[model samples]
Target chain A: MELLGRETRERFGLRSRSQAGILIFSLVSTMMLLSSLYAAEASVFKKAREAAIETASPILKFFAGPIGWIEDRLGAISDYFRVLEQNEALREENAALRQWEEEARSLRGVIAALEELEAYTPPPAAKPINAFVIGEANDAYVHSMIVNAGANEGVSRGFAAVDERGMVGRIVDVSPNAARILLLNDVQSRIPVFVEGSFVEGLLVGRSTSQPTIAITKLANGDKIQPGQRVITSGAGGVLPRGLTVGAVAAVDKKEATVELAADYARSRMVRIINYKFPDVEATPLGAPGAAAAAAEISAAETAPATAADAANLPAAPPAAPAPVDEGD
Target chain B: MSTRADVLMRLAGAATPALLGFLGVILLASPLRLFGGEVPTPVFPLIIVYFWSLYSPGHLPAASVFAMGLTHDLLSGGPIGLWPTVYLVTQQIAISQQAYFLGRDLGVVSIGFAVAALVVSLIVWFVMSLMTATVLPLGGIFWQMLATVACFPLFALAFGRLHRRVVIEV
Candidate 1:
């Protein structure tokens, strides 16, 4: 009877310990979840997350190697099967591009002559950093990818990424060796764009789908945006450069139109991160104006009293600058 | 063998689940781009947590589950704490139903996992939508749940073998 009593006590003790383990761990998990949910952008949690990704980047790259190899092999097989059709299409495209090339050469000469006449100073060339995609997160709520390029490789937040076809996304987070790209299809993505010919400005908003739609569209001269019209970055806010091909309008609904992106998210292994720095308007004057004159102009503009009439005469303030691009944690 | 060696071996055995769980997270996050399509990734860590919690709760503790889920969140660049909470809930459910899972055949075990996957999917979708303040698309989550359910048998087979080889002593 004494032995049976001891066994019973030990059994109860073990059960209680197990229960305590569950309770304590549950509390810890809850605390962690709450902290992560409400943490600030520069909070320790975000920093730690970036550090962890940087440490594990090499491991991810190593694992992607075999998968990329398989993808290449499959692509080669597909290419082999479609070679004849692709060859015919390329032949036609080459013939058309040859004609465009001659026209482009003539236009380049004219533009150079005009620039010389006006003493036009071109903007600095954009530097592109080539990087391989090592990881991807395409779930129901988040759409991002990790490229094997970071601050060390001249990749900074807000730098645009593009594949051979067209725009892919913009870098949002950068660690030492890896950067997170908020893909174009993420719900939080918004880019300033305009129709190719009509120049109707609008915000391209992501819907977490393959195709994003244009919102807050401003039609110029009653020009209606039609399907198949090309879309390009407007460079309104000077974040992205002008004339970067975004996509083609797939469908127009009442006020908005869906765009079929040019960059094939799938099968894009390499991307180019374009490092574009907006020219400082305050620092570089258009002509050879003295510093005092430029300063005088700035102070006059700031000190000039604005009347309701002056405000009305001013051009409508550029459509509410699109919200700063940042993905929620 | 020395006492220290014996203890070390036991600790290592105990850590098998967490180690495997982390590796599964890394593998899932890698850009496999399988079949040249935007395939939804299966929550492999959840499967690992569910399997171990059911088969040997003492070996796979809640803390390890939390660590694995946290790693997944950081690596996948998703909302923080999202997967960790989902995984902790999954572990609790699996532990609560452990008795019912014992002595069950593979088919029954898979069905239980299917149910668990559904619950996990719903929690992720619902919580993410709330966090983002938008009703996220449902099609991706549905396909992800299907993928997770379909891959359960394979993971179970692997984990079962590992359990027999390494975790049994712990």
Candidate 2:
């Protein structure tokens, strides 16, 4: 190694110098390319990238078909061995579900009477469009997928995408017949979520991993959180529907908690794109925007001793938007 | 080893490494997500690029290396030039040190490949960190490197047979 380095230095000739020059040139060119791509014009490049993908999608599908078929066949073969155990588990789950169904029916009757007295009307149920995952983002850093159903199938941007297991992601970009879903674990993803038992609100910012940590923005300093807690979408942002299963807490620390996602992204082949629209916050009763702004101001005004009191003066927990009613398949 | 079909055989021999590199990228991109997200992606191309560049630089040219990297980048959804840069640099380094590996046995080559795989992984991690402007987690990258290193022998065996049957005959 030392000998080679010394030889490279001492025996510098036209050939060696040319090779070194080529290496330097290539390195500089690559760096320049990186800088340009890093600061790429989002609008122009996004359209171009989408167009390029659209054009190439057919070829990709043609190649991917055989591989997908083989994978499914292999999965089927493996499932054959576990069929008995799965059947038993399913039977047990079915019995438990029947009991829950009976309980829900009784609760529904009581809730109906209460709603009649209060004159309450729940939001309409969201329509879900089923789509097969055709391809995933080729880049390792970008956790995303391209589903077959797109604008043609009413799969549009802001629609939350979920699989049978749980929340997968939401539609980011849609073409005529295909849509791109930015998965939950993508770095660019941030969704409002809460602990199921405690109902503690937090921002679930994706760390590009299954074990994404939740930043408890609503919590005061030194507040406690624990492992094994279930996380669910809070629907604070309105883009995502409420009560969607996110994941269970994998680890908890003094400040943040990591969640192990419920959806097995690696193995998920199909997903449902939910057609949902955020309610008009501007026209709401308490003006959610105004209250949110006030909360923000109180949060920012930390130096003042009366900060907590000032926060208290904000709207006393304005009524939450009607939760989206789940419609079972 | 020359015969009436020498030219055709040689051309096919020259193309095998790039074809294998392409297949490696395909295997990574296909539904068979190697190790199922425990590792982001195995450096399959890195193994082939290093093996061929060291053993038979003439058969695997720099142009083919760039093409393989570009193809992978297109399929990978990463920064377009990242893998190309990595592959080209790895190939150059391997070619430069080909003298050291010429008469070495499989064991020595495996050790050399392990070291090369480590270096390649570091380069990829550094470039990706710069691209994302964040210090990314190294665990996945390390796992990917180990996976790539482990799979190198299988590729070596297959490529060795192809080379012996084709190159030696041609």
**Best DockQ among the predictions, by candidate number:** 1
lDDT of 2 by residue, B3-103 (tens): 74777777777688888887776565544553344455566788888888887766766677777776665554455667778777777777677768877
Roughly what TM-score does model 2 have, to 2 decimal places? 0.74
Candidate 2, A142-261: lDDT as tens digits: 577777787889987888888888899888777777777878877666888989877589988777556778988887455467788889999996788898898898998877899999
Q: Which stretches in model 1 have alpha-carbon errors above 4 Å? A: A1-42, A74-103, A284-329, B1-8
At residue B55, give the lDDT of candidate 2. 79
Off by over 4 Å in 2: A1-25, A36-45, A73-96, A107-118, A137-142, A173-176, A220-223, A280-329, B1-16, B34-41, B130-134, B164-170
> RMSD of candidate 1 to the true fold?
11.6
Clashing pairs in 2: A138-B76, A138-B77, A139-B76, A139-B77
On TM-score, the leading prediction is: 1
How does residue A289 of candidate 1 score in lDDT?
45
Fnat of every candidate, listed in order: 0.55, 0.15
**Model 1, B63-135: lDDT tens per residue?**
7777887788887777677787788878877877776898899889999988888888888878667666788
